[model samples]
Target chain A: MSKTIYIAGLGLIGGSLALAIRKAHPTYRILGYNRPEKSQQIARERGMVNDLTDDFASFAPLADIIILAVPIKQTILFLKELAQLDLKKGVIITDVGSTKQEIVAVAEVCFANREIDFIGGHPMAGSHKSGAIAADVSLFENAYYIFTPTQFTQERALTSLKDLFKGTGARYIEVAADEHDRVTSQISHFPHILATSLMLQTGDYAESHEHTKYFTAGGFRDMTRIAESEPDLWTSILLSNSRAVLDRIEEFKERLDEVAQLIFQKNEPAIWKFFNQGRAMRQAMEIHKKGGVDSFYDLFVEVPDEEDVVLKILELLRGISLVNLHINEENREDSHGVLQLTFKNAQDLATAEVIIKNNTDYHITIT
Target chain B: MSKTIYIAGLGLIGGSLALAIRKAHPTYRILGYNRPEKSQQIARERGMVNDLTDDFASFAPLADIIILAVPIKQTILFLKELAQLDLKKGVIITDVGSTKQEIVAVAEVCFANREIDFIGGHPMAGSHKSGAIAADVSLFENAYYIFTPTQFTQERALTSLKDLFKGTGARYIEVAADEHDRVTSQISHFPHILATSLMLQTGDYAESHEHTKYFTAGGFRDMTRIAESEPDLWTSILLSNSRAVLDRIEEFKERLDEVAQLIFQKNEPAIWKFFNQGRAMRQAMEIHKKGGVDSFYDLFVEVPDEEDVVLKILELLRGISLVNLHINEENREDSHGVLQLTFKNAQDLATAEVIIKNNTDYHITIT
Candidate 1:
């Protein structure tokens, strides 16, 4: 028996789910429907789905499972439209929305008397890039995938739905919808707001002093990278979770004010204590490897800032077949360039350290 | 005749300068001094200086050039102490202090009726790791070395000072004392405060919601990297440039408030416009190559998240002798992993793209 899976919205998440499902269960037929007619064609050409349909009413009745991978507002509107349709009995419906409380609330009302079962899902994985073109079959691998089951959701239907995502290699976790919203708000939504605010502050400073922009090094750029996120997507997300985000913002403001007062009073000990606490807190956090997060073991080498010094070091690393190393030369121009060598894991780092120590006179420190 | 250069403070910056001078101009004798009696012995063992002296009175009169590589307050005290000594005729003096205005003012008074000359210098280079153990001879190559000369500064003395640093491969730029303070406050000092504030904000949020720390990604880590800086060093810097940093903070607060207002009102268009402007501004800034700043031509590739997929790609790259490549697997656990391949230059990036295109089925985009 070939299971039919209908994915509404052929964007990064939707398109990727389709690709992963196809690879995991080749006999299953995957159908995709996107708002922009052109995306359906692109999705098909990329082999993201086996079929594309223009009629949602006809498509709604055919799938054993339906996955809504649209914006939060759009997901609600689509759910309402699906409620009017005669969905298949024992059919399972889920969504990959960032926020869950509002979406799950809509699902309760829409499927109150319907045979379809709804599960609210939020995949904690995405690229900085978007759309079907950026989709991949293995995207959900090792990523955390949260599913919020409604009170009316059936055990068998939930099991079937979980089976559909078995190929994704995701770590499935269950949480209440409200808990989902609150947790995501703290970790994801609030950070985005802070990143944007920091960007605005930096932009304003740069406007007044044009030369200041040139002086912004890695720290400023890293702080503001999230500000370059797609505005339409972020604006929608911010508004959708406005209440929770706003609450976090208030808390953040209080903390900022305390630091500001310390700076104003020129209280050296207080400021130092504040920063020291922050440093310890930050260092204690477990490094996340999913999304667009970087994970590398860093090796700091104290070397002279000569033109060919980095090249010579790279050549030595190459001699040991360690080609994946990155050389950070930010300090090379000012002082003895402390070259930062990045490796994938501890074993590789340890190996590189031994090689450098034995082959060269440079002092190395593992960070 | 050999030129004698006395470097006071055998720390990272000062120690590195001594090593570089010795490497580039071996005949020029380098003398080192530090308040800690033990540091003099360590400095000698490291070969950072040709000689070490405990008596400043004797050391001050035997040099053609004297570099006070100490903290701002210590530099001022050292200058005052040197003023009392019977210094040699035409001895050029310079201090590698972070701030210049106050230091230059003190230098003016200290050298008023003395034969010794003083020029304010701030080498725009340093690493997170401090002290002589982290020093390297090539630290200043291609780095900007800013000098703030007092009104009484002699051109002959300035020329001699410039000649002493010729071997360091630094680009010398002269700016007024106040100008140096204002510009540095905008670029360096103010950013540090903002970074610290952000860290504190995040820390507060994490205290209430402990799980939030586990979700912090690359952006959070990068933003807070500077926050991990030595607290005592940062406290001294922030205090020395308090006035200018405070002014910048006021400007930053005003901008942040406006952003807060936009978020509070859910002004979609305004928020969108703000982010869009910030994105443009951030992208326009010159990419710096110091510290842990990334400086590589990036190529984004879409590949499945299988266990050996990245290894396979690396193997392919290695076959082509592409050893200086950095693979950023930020999205490996989600969607198709968009691996960012970093190359040394554009030409190398182009070559890798061609090789990958010819060898693999993956789609690549140069960013």
Candidate 2:
């Protein structure tokens, strides 16, 4: 028996993982440890886990598996405390944090002679929303969950932990702690930094020119929505992952400057060509089959009279492969005997039109 | 009695406007004239307008409102031809194009005789998928429709046309043709260019590092979806709106450089403060009631058992002043429990999370 698993800091990422684990292994016992009475109450009320406790002594001793899903500073503090506490001898321990090298380094020093095993993990899943209330079981579905274990990491324990996340729809990848931080900084953290900058630029511009209110639309909204994320969390991410984030920011700046220089030269053709190259590269991205993760591509669509229409539209959309399709009849309706359809793909808009022209009286349009 | 309106180039925009006009004013005759025989056939078959024809000369003589809903190049050419044509006196000509200043400048020269007034109009409504086949009447609903006219523009004619556009769910705004182009270039064109560049960067990185395949998700997809937009249309937009687009691109690059410098210096606190400023600005923007033309803030949500749940949720959301909620449901319970709720404010996602927590049994989580 895998027995019960105890997760410290039952917040957004931690609570969500508990739900995911529950869904995948319904029979397994899951325990949560969090600060404040409300989070523990909400976790129990929401049935996010089987049990909750604030005491690390009692919780850590009876666990087959333990996960530290807390902030970097707190996670370090928790590791130090856990090093002194009485924990199950053969227990496997993991963590969910944005930065890995720092935490892993702390773990190495704290647990060197303590028989405690530490394997760092980072789930690429993120949202502007936060806290225990935001936790969902499907958060890790097919998301690229990475495990960073140092040379001293016990392979058997790491393998067992990896097995726990198997059916939770998260794909496991292994890398050095430093490399994980570096790669994620480039791909994830840097983008957030850039997105914040874009929003601030517009905000500064808006302060001076009142007319910006009338001008900025969907494009700006989508670009800046993530700007609303928690400030402290992002602060930690940037500070801890500064080196890698800065490197990627430089890469972005280089590209941006290239376009700026071309514009300064009044090279219209070159500018168009540059933008064209970007457009082509974007279009060529493999947007199909993201495998059950909470991907932005999973824009649920409402298409009325879905059964026949979905099949026909799917047939026409064979020209373009889509990652996932879920039909919601409530969001869509056949207005005046016209089947209204929505899709996640640009090509699907054309495909929907093709299907409508061939079969239904549906007025297919992209929203 | 308002006489028949003639729309040249019966493509998506023109055809849709013709349908909207007809729907809004059922008594008025809508005429569609296309140079392409196939498009003419499509227009007639789709009943896009009451009368469809290929002979522009014959139709031009009888038109009360002449809308140049054609390609930008052709729109200028037709304006020149209309300057010489023997048409109904006081016939107002309007255009539907992305860029306005160039067209208005050319129209100023073409229609030197203010008798045949050419007012530049752009309904910021379109789909990535377009053509005569995809044209529909309701495309302009709740969209931002702007009319850019010079000092010599006929005010009475502008009002008459505005009356015709009334009740189409499109709010009309007046702006200078040059200013319109400049502002949209920053808000619209620059974002598309930025998105394309970002996508290209991802592609280049992915080609070199296979690990990027796992990293790409919602944030990336939303950032790049517009990147996959019609390349040919973008080419035309970039070339025509070159000056404004280039200026905006430079502005974006400057901002990007600023952010890169901050990140490079590892200024974590500055990053947080800057991001928070943006967050507050974006949050304030959610107060706009009309939700603008590009459907920018009007994001729809779809979830299982979303109909009754979303309606009840909308009722709860109505108590909040920050967001405008619109929930469409006619079939009620007979309708599948799935609901599609469209929020006039993007910031409503945070609020909606609160509502979902209170009302829905189906676990609503975002991680």
Candidate 3:
């Protein structure tokens, strides 16, 4: 049966999902409210969606699937507004918000008497750029798309929503609302706070010590990179997810104190164990990347910091079509082997490796 | 004035310094003891050094300068051994150690009565790859080379040492031993410990939360990138600079708690101020980077994740001889503008910008 998928926001997440859904299910009509955003305007100009509506409330009731891809606070407001609307039967409403617990609570309260099922969503894929202009069909590809279900949520709603977002090529994980907040706080939200704190500390130190900023090498720079993110967005993320962020901060202090004591006592073995365990765990994380694919092979190449260097490497492997080539900003802490290339099969990777070695003087390390 | 410069431990730092020195002052006689490491062996085979030493103490008397590029603990031992050796007068000895206070204190005790000056050196540049084989002549190029001078160090020694290392192309900063330790702990050492702690916390959180590992996104992965660094090297660094690291941890906790309070209170303006300050500081640091040059212009291009995409951009700017093209892993937090290209003049950058705009659909922003 043909259905209307009404997307409420046309920012990065909303716009990307519209493109992904359209490509995934051409039968469904994608009706979205194009805000005054440049990304949304550009997407409309490109004819990404089936239709546009300024009257969100009137058109919202026609949506079989409503995606609230607004800010966390606004998502709550949308849920409230969406609750009173006369929606289609068996409609599944979801959101792409950063924090889930509060939104899920509001969702459960709003949709309790209604036939519609609201599932909290947090798609963990985005770039520094915002808006639909920066949106791509593969924005969430290989990234984690999480679902936090409420007591009112049914299996039919969950599975249908998952199928709809499947075109994104993302890995799906279901988590409880509070548990989701705790986990995200441990990973994303708290890390942002820490990065900001580190920068502030370094900046404070630099005020007294001249040229201290100049001494921060690759590692320090990498750790504090997230501090450069937009403050208003982060402020909302932190405020909305306060409990989890605070708990993470407390937990982080304990973990840090443990290592600090080990260093203070001059316990080399313990300190080594601390760093080595982290290294081992981080390496393990890499192996689990793209876990669903057995045929995909990863190739890491060490590129030097020179003009048109990466171009030179690609020039060597011109004939072979690669699946993906990401500059592993993570591995960039080291000066070598920063480019991580993905191939759908081993044969392509092998051919690319031989071509790089035979044609260029660059160091090729397969990790 | 062709003087023999003996460098002990041809690791990444020592080997790169030797190469930089040779290219800078071709007439200088460079002698170094190559270790049983692959990096050193490769450097030796490449004729990066003029002479090799089997017995460092026996060859110590003939050198005008010596650089101890061993591990921090080993550097302390080498300093002790060199002190007792009948050394050449006015011989300047320096060690490339992470922690300066401990090593500089050791140097003062060992070289107090001798005519040689033991000026502590820490070249704030290195890759994840250790050993001389991984060393490049431009390893320390455009990096900070810090000097921690003792009370007995004279103007003659400082100037001569600076002159000798001119080939490194590193900006020199003179900081006191205690201040050096404190500053580095704020920027590098403390951040390393924090990164490890974050990874360990995430791993532990994953134990109870199913699929938690799969949920960690780019931001989390980026903040913990340095956790993948070597254990043994970091262990020595943390131990040698225990006091400063401990102090930094205390200060960090306070800074973190301040934000925590503001977040808990839901003071959005205050929280925004905290993060905005960090963003401003981090941005300020970038402007100061390569501050010596007046003609340098930086261009940031937002490249999408596609196979051979960067190659396409480089193809557009083929005629422009860019001074540098660095893949900023830091900016990878954002989905766009990851490639940072440097041009010596505004004309080249403007030309490259036009070429990119005309040739491709990629977004370009001048920073």
Candidate 4:
């Protein structure tokens, strides 16, 4: 029998999940629910779902599995509404939210006397770009999919949910709801706030010193890139995970204040140790090998400024199975340029390095 | 008549300047001075300079131009020692340091009763990689070289120094020493500290939650990339510009604390306004063109995941006059990949985009 999977919120995650399941299981029927009716119509036109609905009451009883891919607040409201509905027995329900503790707590209350199984999930994979237009079947490939289940959750339902997501090529790890919220607050949410703060600080400085704006080079740009993130989405996240974010901020401020005091005292040894600690910690991050996520080895090659010379070098590399080649054009002048080549794996980079050494006289350095 | 130039400090900046000047003016004699004598010896073997000297007192009076390229503290000390030399009549003296006010002030006091001319200079070009091995002849080509001259500076001396650096193809800008320090502290020094603090915060978070380390993605990496910078170098910079750095930190903290309050109170309107402000300010930054400094236009193209398919697309682009091509390897899985092409100028990017549109069916987006 073909399973009926209902996905609420036809945005990037929901749309991509629907498409991935459709591609993998031709017989499974995917139904998408979203607001305004236009999004549902679009999702149908895009072939992301076999059916579309704006009303949840009619579809709640038909779904064997339900995935809520909305913001944290909306997901809570939807869980409350679903609790009032007569969902099928043994139905599996889950959510793709940035925070888990709040949502999982609500799920526990809503399903306390109900038959529906609720599990909180988060896929640690997404782009800055959002919406259905940016959706892809490969978004979750090799990504870590974290699941948080309550004591009331059934093992059969958890196993089935894992099997369903297996076709998306995600690695699964089960964690406690509170633990998921705390860890993500540290790694993802807190860093985002820092990026935004850095931008505002630089922007304030740029207002007085206009030339400083022009001097905002690669490092500054990279450090604050997340400042360009979606406002509505981030606001929802910040509000839902307020306690954890604020706690992390207080901890960060203490660390920064220590450095600030050291600078004021002109304490050279203390400052040296602080900087070395940061460097050592950053260098200790384990490089992910199999993920389609962000793990790359970069190689920089010095090339002459001539267009023909750079083209010739690319031509030579095109014959080899390398990953990506780009010119560091901003770092180039009229006489010299730097060519950056990226590889998904280290072996591919080694192979390209050998080929370049055997073929060209260009100086290459792996960064 | 050919001129002689003496450069103290054979690190990345000084060594590259020597090689660039040598390439442009073949007949000009260049002498390099560095400690331990081994660095100067290596520079000579690499053809960076004509002569190597460890004793600065014997060689300081022989050159028409003297360049002091060292850290901020060392640059000030060198100025005092150079002021004691009595042979030179009108030799133009300059030092390349990140902070300008202190160095320029020291130079004024040292050269008050002497015949030597002292001027402050800062070249706004550098790489994360340092040392003699990373030095190249074209490092300063099209880079911004700022000069701060005291009230006692001679017009003829300024003109002669400009003429000497013209061969290296650096664009010149004259500004007040205090103004340069203030602007650089805003854009460069403050951002470095923020990067370090973000890393420390994340490191603290990762200690208890080990799984959090694996979830650090592109945004986190980009924001903390400079955290891997040299400890001693950054220590010197933070201390030398401690006042400005601390001021900026206080200002930044005010803004961050405001946002944290809004998040705590669930002030949706205020949070929306703050995020929009950051986005607008980031969008308003002027894109730099025609510099050896970092600036590039990025174009993204969707391609199939096969190695041969990617190679074929690269081959097609190789036939075009594109400057740099890199693949977004972290974004690629078994079925989908995006290739990024970078161009030095806007015109070249448009040309390549048109060529790709005309020749292939690949979906392209200029980011």
Best by TM-score: 4
Q: Native-vs-model 3 lDDT?
A: 0.79
Per-residue lDDT of candidate 3, residues B157-221 (tens digit): 98988998998878798989898888888888899999989998888888987666766766676
Per-residue lDDT of A118-210 in model 3, one digit per residue for the tens?
888988777776776656677777677889986678999999999899998887988888888887788788999999899888888899888
* Model-by-model DockQ, in order: 0.28, 0.25, 0.43, 0.42
Candidate 1 chain B weakest ten by summed lDDT: B286-295
lDDT of 4 by residue, B57-126 (tens): 6788888899998888788888888888874788889988888888888889988877788889988778
Q: Could you say which candidate leads in DockQ? A: 3
lDDT by residue for model 1 (A72-135), tens = 8788988999999887887889999988888998989998877888999987778765777767
Give me the displacement of residue B32 in model 2, in angstroms: 3.1
Clashes of each: 13, 5, 9, 9
Which residue ranges in model 2 land beyond 4 Å of their true spot? Answer: A1-4, A19-31, A46-64, A80-91, A112-114, A126-129, A261-276, A288-367, B1-4, B24-30, B49-62, B83-89, B287-367
Model 2 lDDT per residue over B185-236, tens place: 7667777777777777777877866667666666666556667666666766
Q: Candidate 2 on A1-367: residue-level lDDT in tens?
A: 6578999988878888888777767788998898767668778877877878887667888888889998887888888888888888877888999899888988889888877788999887855446676676656765778999888888898888877776556778888888777766655666676567666666666665555667776666666666776777788888777777767767776777776676657565776677677666655656433422345222233344433444454444444434334333222223222333333334455664665567644444432
> Could you give the CAPRI-style class of model 4?
acceptable
Alpha-carbon runs more than 4 Å astray in model 3: A37-40, A287-367, B34-40, B287-367
**Ranking, DockQ, top scorer first:** 3, 4, 1, 2
Task: Using DockQ as the measure, name the better of candidate 1 and candidate 4.
Answer: 4
| lDDT score, candidate 1, position B108 | 87
